[model samples]
Target: MILSTLDLNPVIDLTDEQFYQLCQANPEVKFERNANGTLVIMSPTGGETGNRNFEIGADFAIWNRQTQLGICFDSSTGFRLPNGAQRSPDIAWIKQSRWQALTPAQRERFPPIAPDFVLELLSPSDTLPASQTKMQEYINNGVQLGWLIERKTRTVQIYRPGKPVETLNNPSQLSGEAILPGFTLDMSLVW
Candidate 1:
């Protein structure tokens, strides 16, 4: 890490509220780290990272078939963890009901709870142990399911409560089973 003193102007510390306004002024800037010490998300753009496996994520949401519900490809939306960590998922399933439960005022604020489901696409530079712990974090915070997609192997690591670890490799099809009934993702699209 490079640390250097600025010679242009005196170093100024901005509060969280002030930093937000600065981001507003400079639309091109993306300030992931904040003064409050939030853990900026470490994930990739689903559109670019896994254009090959998109159908899988799409098929899962399509199986759900609820218009008020949908999947998020970019890790833009974030929810604060109980531990104050703010890790975003590459993809998330936001059910209408759970979301509607929030009042308009509350919706404007960071959600107190995590999404119903999360999917993490593994990049070549990503570490398995870190993603595994993130998967567990979802379950610990009441997430129903978490999918860790391995791009190279074209496999998925499924995480569910009270279930054994499952690694499906080039399966004919992938199903959300009961969690997302009738949702079948044709693996052929991914390969």
Candidate 2:
């Protein structure tokens, strides 16, 4: 199923702590907060999408283990962006230095920083426009590199700071570039 968003305008606004509690209470549900405070409730992905997400996360994890240059996170980790949005990318990475800057307490909660690199894998239920908008948000909030992979079309949208969005069609692999030197994602498993 597609994701659903709720705008709780008439109701009292939920404080960050309250949101955290709510999330903790509902462990089975996936939630996100937009910069404007809209609550997004996303359903669990289908089996195929879940498997793809696992494969993508595993690839990043292996690369991270080899390089030790950064920490990789799976979809379940939430990050509080500078713009006040709480986002959980399908796959995310933060530089070791940036991660080390956070205190132990901060690391235990949703990190209040943008990820250096993010990857969003599009499931069949996801809309292209919505995914593109999310990528733009990530870029605007200081994400240096972002990838929106659309399995349906075999297309990848690459987002880089201060650069126009680049589109690749059916690419066999994606380079991590300077941001993640010596890292490459094999598209065979993802596609």
- Candidate 1's displacement at residue 40, Å, is 3.4
Cα lDDT, all candidates: 0.60, 0.91
- Please list all clashing residue pairs in model 1, or write none if there are none: none
Q: Tell me the lDDT of model 2 at 132.
A: 91
* C-alpha lDDT (0 to 100) for residue 49 of candidate 2: 90
Query: Can you write out model 2's per-residue Cα lDDT over 1-191, one digit (the tens) per residue?
Result: 24789888469688778888889999999999999889999778889999999988888899899989999998889999999889999999999999999999888989988999999998878888888989999999999999999998899999999999999999999999999899899999988
Give per-model TM-scores. Answer: 0.69, 0.97
- In model 2, the runs with Cα more than 4 Å from the true position are none
Candidate 2 lDDT (Cα, 0 to 1): 0.91
Residue-level lDDT tens digits of model 1 in 1-191? 00121221145544445544654675453333322453233334445466754655566556556643543434555555454444557667766777778778655545555777777777765678767877777777777877887767888888887676688876776666565555666766755
